[model samples]
Target: MMKTILLIVTNIEQYASGHLKTGLWLSELTHIYHAAKEKGWKITIASPKGGNTPIDPESLKPLVLDGISKSYYENPVFMNELAQTKSLDMVKNDSFDCIYLAGGHATMYDFPDNTTLQEILRDQYESNKMVAAICHGVGGLLNVRLSDGEYMIKGKAVTGFDWFEETLARRKNEVPFNLEAALKERNVHYRKAFIPMTSNVVVDGSLITGQNPFSSKEMAKVVVSELEKQAFM
Candidate 1:
């Protein structure tokens, strides 16, 4: 059977201050999407609320935009997918082999407290399927609780956009809360790269996470590798 992936992105398009435009980080979705596509897996893009998803302007900057992400940015079909994502309520959680949270600073405002998102994650996780996130996307994992009432990520090794990386990005004070601290408070064995903004990935059984935007490609590689392993087993 072909594996399917459910990608969850935030709907918020700006900062709480309303001065900065922020939404899904383009590379986070592109890297993972292409990785899975290369393996001939199905991909579905969805959001907390079904509608157009905004892109973080900073992600489109020339210095940061990679070839793959840039190509998708210029592709009308791919851009249309972002403009018409399925709402969480419209998705069936049990159908996907994996559920991924794609991050942008906007995710900090929307991903954590979404009840529907939490439910989908809880279902996918409790069912023993893959749950993955990258950068601030890991914020979605903060509030997900299994049936026993434990945070799904509790005691599992994980990583996300670290506080220092926020400082490096010059948004340490702009973000709503400290993501690294939140993950630690949940008691997950959180880890990060020694050098900021570099690739760092953690795999704890079925939960896979990447430390920052730069980690997306490598993280997706790991996700595909693991899923391929599970498919054959």
Candidate 2:
């Protein structure tokens, strides 16, 4: 039987700041999705509101988009998936072996405060299914509360789009909110790359988090590794 991966992304097309376009980070999804596909895992891309997920324009820049991401960029079939993402409500929590949140400035806006997404994360997580996110994608984990009425991240060591990293990228203000502060608000034990924008992936049991966009591919490898281990047991 094929394993299933639920790759969640943001549907928000742009930021309120204007002029700066935002959506899903192309490489974030491509790196992981392609890996899962090669393993013959069934990949279902979902979004909060669903339908026509947008891609961050900056992620497509010549400096960034290349290799697997560049290939996905030019493929019409892959492009169609962005326009055909299933809504969060359409997903059956029990069907997926893992749920991954993709990042972009768009995720910073929509990932948090979504009741449906929160429910899915909470249910799947409590059931021992794997959950992962990267960059601003970590925003989705900050607000997930457990059945015990405590924040899921309360004691978990995690990391994501850091305020300092955002500053280094010179897009701190462009981001919707201070994700670092929000995670701390729930008493989340947070950490970051020793060097800014470094590829950092933290594994705390079933939950995995990445420090920045650069961490996406490695993060995917970690998830695949975990899946491989689970297959043996």
Candidate 3:
């Protein structure tokens, strides 16, 4: 039987001061979606608000576009899946073998501090399911707590779009808060590439994370590898 995965994206548009537009980064979803499809896993998209999640226009630039995401944009069926995404409230725990959070500036505004999302991560972690996030999407992990009342990410080695990447993108001032600073404040062992915007994926047990949009493909490969190992075991 093919495994099922739930991928979450943000519905927020403007990140800060309504200057920097935000939505799900198409590359983040496409790389993982295609990788999972090739490995025979079914994927579903969900959002905190649900319905008609938008894509960041910047992410759709020819230089950033991947073949899978470009194709996904043209496929009516796939577009409909994104158009009618399930709300976080409607999802049940333990239904998916893996849960991935895709990133864009919007995630910083909506993905973090969501109670429903926190519960989903808690349940997924407790069930030993693979939990992954990339770029700003790692913001979603900020509030997740384990059943024992400890932070799910406490002391874990993880990576996400770094503060330097934000600076490179020239949105350092527009972002509400510094994600790297926030994670470090919580005692999370956050890692990053030496250079900004490089592809870096980190896997620590059941938790997997990628540094930026450039890292999503590697992130997905790592997750699928873990899932395959678990399935055989």
Candidate 4:
């Protein structure tokens, strides 16, 4: 069966600080986008307010923009799709086999407390479907509560951008809240790499996560593998 993936991103363009810009991290989405595309999975991009999604300017820098991201940026169809993402309000949660939250510092602003997004997360998770997020995308999973009123990832082993990484990058002051702290508050078993900026991926059944942009592709591959496993059985 051909699988479908809901690629969710932040609509926020800048941070509260006003000096720094933050939006969707390109590689986080591009890597997973290509990976899923190679597997012939359909993907839909959506945001909370449902319109244009902002790609972080820093992500497009020559130093950061690799061939994959550069090609994605150059694709008019892909750029148009990102610029006009469907609204989350219009999304049917059960329509897709998986939901991938693409990360950026902006995701921290809108992902955690959005009730509608939480509903989608709960729907996908409780249905035994794959739910994955990378980098700041992990913020989306922080507040997802199932019908039983338990945090969706309470006992699940997961990995995301760590406090050490944030502090190392000096973004702790600019971010709205501490991601690692919020994960802990929700009783999540957060994991990270021994060294900052290193890739890390964690797969606990249907719940899959990657620590940073470096791990997004790996996370996507694992998602494909998990989907294949489910299809076989």
**How high is the CA lDDT of each candidate model?**
0.93, 0.88, 0.88, 0.88
* Model 1 agreement with the true structure over 1-233: per-residue lDDT tens digits: 58999998989999988778899999999999999888888999999998999999999999889999999999999999999999999995448999999999999998999999999999998889999999999999999999999999999999999998898899876899999999999999989999999999999999999999999889889988998899788
Model 2 lDDT per residue over 132-180, tens place: 9998999998788899999888889999888887787678778778988
Cα-based TM-score, every candidate: 0.98, 0.96, 0.96, 0.96
User: Would you give me the overall lDDT of model 1?
Assistant: 0.93
Candidate 3 lDDT, 1-233, residue by residue in tens:
58999999988877668766778898998888888888778888899988978899889999888787899888898888888998998885449999999999889988889999999999999888889999999999988989889889999998888888888888888888899998887788889998788799988999999989899778888888888888887
lDDT of 3 at 36: 86
1 versus 4: better TM-score goes to: 1
Candidate 1 vs candidate 2: the TM-score winner is 1
Count of steric clashes across candidates, in order: 0, 0, 0, 0
* Model 1: lowest-lDDT 10 consecutive positions: 89-98
Clashing pairs for model 1 are none
Winning candidate number (TM-score) = 1
Give candidate 1 regions above 4 Å deviation. none
